[model samples]
Target: MEKLEQEMPLDPFEHIIFDYFPVYVEADVEAFLDLTSDQEKKKCTLEIVHAGMKRAAQAFNWDLQILEKVYHTIKQTGYKSIFALLKKSSPNKKYVCSIMCHHEVKRMDVYVEIKKRSGIVVKKEKLFSVKNTDEQDLLSEYGTLTWTLNHKVEFADKDYKKVYRLTFLEKDKPEDLVWKMERYEL
Candidate 1:
């Protein structure tokens, strides 16, 4: 059996703002709500989220004073950056991570093992920066990357969980932000 490591006490503010990983928590909450479609299930999910925040507080042993700093860190750093730093320090694990605009750019360094392939030859190349937030900016950044594909691969992963999909369609050579999101749920 393994014992948990001793946690250092955090200031008061840190305790309050724990578990502010909003996106994942929102997904989990949505999943719970869709599972049973009942009020009891909704209440249970809310309780679960509440308990998770409390557990995070207890794990860090934080108090009220540290909450502001904790919130700032969460707002600025995000959960992925910490994970990205750890991933970067490790050797040859076949993963790459970086920050892009307000999102995380996580890619598998291991040549994505395509079960099926795409034949569309993208004879283009583009340079991108982290500060570019506009959709047009992203398109322009990736506008020059020329990738040549020779196989028609099924885009969807054949996994049990519902997989959401998005395909970016560019109308002009400069490329526009007019991409569309299609989903199984929709």
Candidate 2:
């Protein structure tokens, strides 16, 4: 392994690697697994979620305490299980964005407050609700909670291009909508 390493690139960051069990999987190799089938889809989704979480941790340089919790949560709950990333100082940070949860299909319709622009949400619609009070307080302080969901659908709706406009009856603007993540198949 050391001999091979001498020939390989030094910067591990330049090349994305997936640490699957004991082996290192290149990004392209993992991407090839078909997620369309019933069983394969579930497994693939889990892998993607795990990879995304790891990437986020590495990118953010999250605190050791938070990182330790994330590791335990992923291991215990499994990659497909839903998880929350709570914000500490920023109220806008709290909320569940994990697509792995079953209830998310219905719950994504809700919204919360953003306190003092304390964190990273650039657009208001992009933010969603979480179980944390600080996150809710932040959202409440920024603006009242709203759900424009016709709540997006997965699998079934992946084929459609048009975004379904959802809005709260009390408001004039369509705040949210149901749509699928775009993918191109050649």
Across 98-149, the per-residue lDDT of candidate 2 in tens digits comes to 2111223113223221222334332223333434334334333332122223
Q: Which residue segments of model 2 deviate by more than 4 Å? A: 1-43, 78-186
Off by over 4 Å in 1: 1-28, 31-51, 55-61, 77-186
Query: For model 2, how big is the CA root-mean-square deviation?
Result: 14.4
Please report the TM-score between candidate 1 and the true structure. Answer: 0.19
lDDT of 1: 0.32
Q: Write the per-residue lDDT of candidate 1 for residues 1-186, one digit (tens) a residue.
A: 021222444344543545443211223545554555344453444445444455455556767346556545554553322211111111222222121232333221111121112323222111122443344443333322111222211122224132223233334562552433333421
Alpha-carbon TM-score of each model against the true structure: 0.19, 0.24
RMSD of each: 16.5, 14.4
lDDT of 2 at 139: 31
Error of 2 at 151 (Å): 25
Q: Which candidate comes out best when scored by lDDT? A: 2
